[model samples]
Target: MAADLVSRVKTDPNFIELEAKRGAFGWTIAISMVVIYFAFIFMVAFFKDALSVQVYGVITLAFPLGILVLFSAFVLVGIYVVRANGEFDDLTKKIVEKAR
Candidate 1:
């Protein structure tokens, strides 16, 4: 049964399209997050003095930038959830129905 399903899946254009779209979107999101995270790490490692410098009276640039990084994680997760629940879920349901 599983083999038959796999055969059907392999031949289906919709399956191919879905895989392509999902792979592309997943990789894009993954790469973006990695770049954002590594950028913060790199900044911390190489530009320690800049991050240490006071932005206002007492608050430093590092504090705000660190907060921005944390905020960005939540924002990125929201983005993925929206896409997965909406577009990706719709496509997945369509494919499953066709398989059935």
Candidate 2:
């Protein structure tokens, strides 16, 4: 069945194009996220003192805020994973079926 599907994909131009487009979009999102996250870290490191603020009317909050932002990136990645696995996986399955 797998071999049959592979043969069909090879013969189906639409399936091939959809697969390529999906791959490109996924990679683009991944790379953009990595670059933006690193840039945020670099910015925070360079401007820590400038951005620091007292919280609860006492403790400094700069470090905590930075950590929160970093943690939120992981949350964003989780969302990306859910969307990609749910939507993109379905799209790929459809393409494969059509190819087959």
Candidate 3:
């Protein structure tokens, strides 16, 4: 069965198109994520001093005590997960279906 599906995927133009579409979507997501992560790093470097703070006692000891840095990390992770599980996963599933 698996071999049959592989043979179809190799011979079918539609399956090939779906596979290429999936790859393009995956690459787009990856490149956007890399750009966004680097932009965050650049922002952090440019505004390091702004993030420096001495909070009341316990919070002061914690790293990235600033709200900006914490929220930035949270938003970045949220974006990554949403994109990965939503767009990329859907594309991959479609490609698999086409292959079969």
Task: Give the Cα lDDT of each candidate.
Answer: 0.88, 0.71, 0.63
- Model 3 error, position 41 (Å): 0.9
Model 2 lDDT tens row, 1-100: 5887678777677666656766787787678778767776776779777556677576667666667667877876887788778776776787767763
TM-score of each: 0.87, 0.58, 0.44
The whole-model C-alpha lDDT of candidate 2 against the native structure comes to 0.71
Error of 2 at 36 (Å): 4.1
* Top lDDT hit: 1
Order the candidates by TM-score, highest first: 1, 2, 3
Candidate 1, position 56, lDDT:
94
Across 1-100, the per-residue lDDT of candidate 3 in tens digits comes to 6888778767666556655765676676567667766765775678665445456664532254335555666776676678668766776677678764
- Candidate 2 total steric clashes: 0
TM-score of 1: 0.87
Candidate 2 Cα misplacement greater than 4 A, ranges = 1-28
lDDT of 1 by residue, 1-100 (tens): 6999989977788778878887898888888889999999999999999999998999999999999989888888888889888888888888888899
lDDT of model 2 at residue 61?
71
